[model samples]
Target: MSKRGGSRNPSSERARGRDREERREREREREREREREREKRERERETEREREREREREREIEREREIESEREREREREREREREREGERGREGERHWKNRREGHDGEKSGVCVCACTRERERERERERERERERERERERERERERGRERE
Candidate 1:
């Protein structure tokens, strides 16, 4: 009876030791799975952060492009305005030149008319004096007419 009881105690101890080792192996596998899950989560978060940063950079680039385009348009408009103003000033100068030419022509024509009137008056006075001398010399003696004409 003592030998049987001792053999039974050793068999029961061996079974408990096998069960403990199996339990330990299962726990290790569970820990490994949890670690893998944690690593995957960290990788997913990093990828999302990178994508967000890229999106922000793209938006900033677009804003800069828009601002540059607006500045170019404003500069072009100012240049056009200056060109128009110069054209207007040139036109005004031309008009003033034309007006001055017209005034000079009018002054020359008035001077020519006054010179013609003076020439006509001098010719009429010479004709009237020649007629009066012919009337005073009617039927005079030859020698006396010659003396009076000379005096």
Candidate 2:
């Protein structure tokens, strides 16, 4: 089998060169795919880290809110206790004032009764002196008047 109508059989050389070029192109394509896969993996890791940080921040905020609520409740309880103490003191003071007023009224009434008794005694003395002066002026009738007075 002789090569037909070919000066140098250049077809074989051209075919080999084309095959080598195709192999090189295939290798470049595979390398590009591997680089894309690596980039995707790095992006996924970054996203996971960001999500974890956000969750931690949310937990911290929740703790702060709980602490603030507890503080407010404690303050309210303290205020209520103070108010109760004040009410008790006020009631005791009112009772003491009422007792003082009652004692003063009783003392005033006793003094008034004493004054009335003294006035009555003075009036009786003045009436007895007037009767004695009238009896001296009528000595004849003094004995009969004295008997009448005794009866």
Candidate 3:
């Protein structure tokens, strides 16, 4: 009798099964590659974010340093003003002592009328000097404000 038409070839079936398994493995490998690529992208984004944060922090530090420097300059200017005021006071004291000595000498050597006139002239000169000094101090303060405001 002829072989039955429905009979299957066992070797051919095994070969087909092996083919399917290999295809599935290839697909699994592709999926793993895609997953690795996604993880790499995420890491890159995280690194970029960290860099941005660091740059911003550096900028903040620079601003703080500039503000501190400005404050220091202001303090220095105030100290200089105080020193000038002290010097002016010393000068005025010297002038007053000189005037007192001159008046004592004139009292012994000059007539009373001439001594009185000289005293008036010395008093007027001292007043004029005081007025000039006040104007100079005001001008210096104005200049200081102008120069410091821009820097």
> Which candidate gets the maximum TM-score versus the true structure?
3
Shift in Å, residue 79, candidate 1: 1.8
| Candidate 2 lDDT score relative to the true structure | 0.74
- Indicate which candidate wins on lDDT: 3
Q: After superposition, how far is residue 107 of candidate 2 from its true place, in Å?
A: 14
The positional error of residue 39 in candidate 2, measured at the CA in angstroms, is: 1.2
lDDT of 1 by residue, 1-151 (tens): 3676455577878999999999999999999999999999999999999999999999999999999999999999998887788762565444433444234546422222233345766678877877777666663566687899999
| Residue 41 local lDDT, model 2 | 94
Structural RMSD, model 2 = 29.7
- Please give, for residues 54-106, the per-residue lDDT of candidate 2 as tens digits: 99999999999999999999999998887777762565444443444234446
Query: 1 or 3, which is superior by lDDT?
Result: 3
TM-scores of the candidates in the order shown:
0.51, 0.48, 0.53
Please give the range of 10 consecutive residues that has the lowest summed lDDT in model 3.
105-114
Q: What is the C-alpha RMSD of each candidate to the true structure, in Å?
A: 31.3, 29.7, 14.8
Alpha-carbon lDDT of model 1: 0.74
Q: What is the per-residue lDDT of model 3 for residues 84-129, given as tens digits with 9 covering 90 to 100?
A: 8876257544444444443554653323334555788999999999
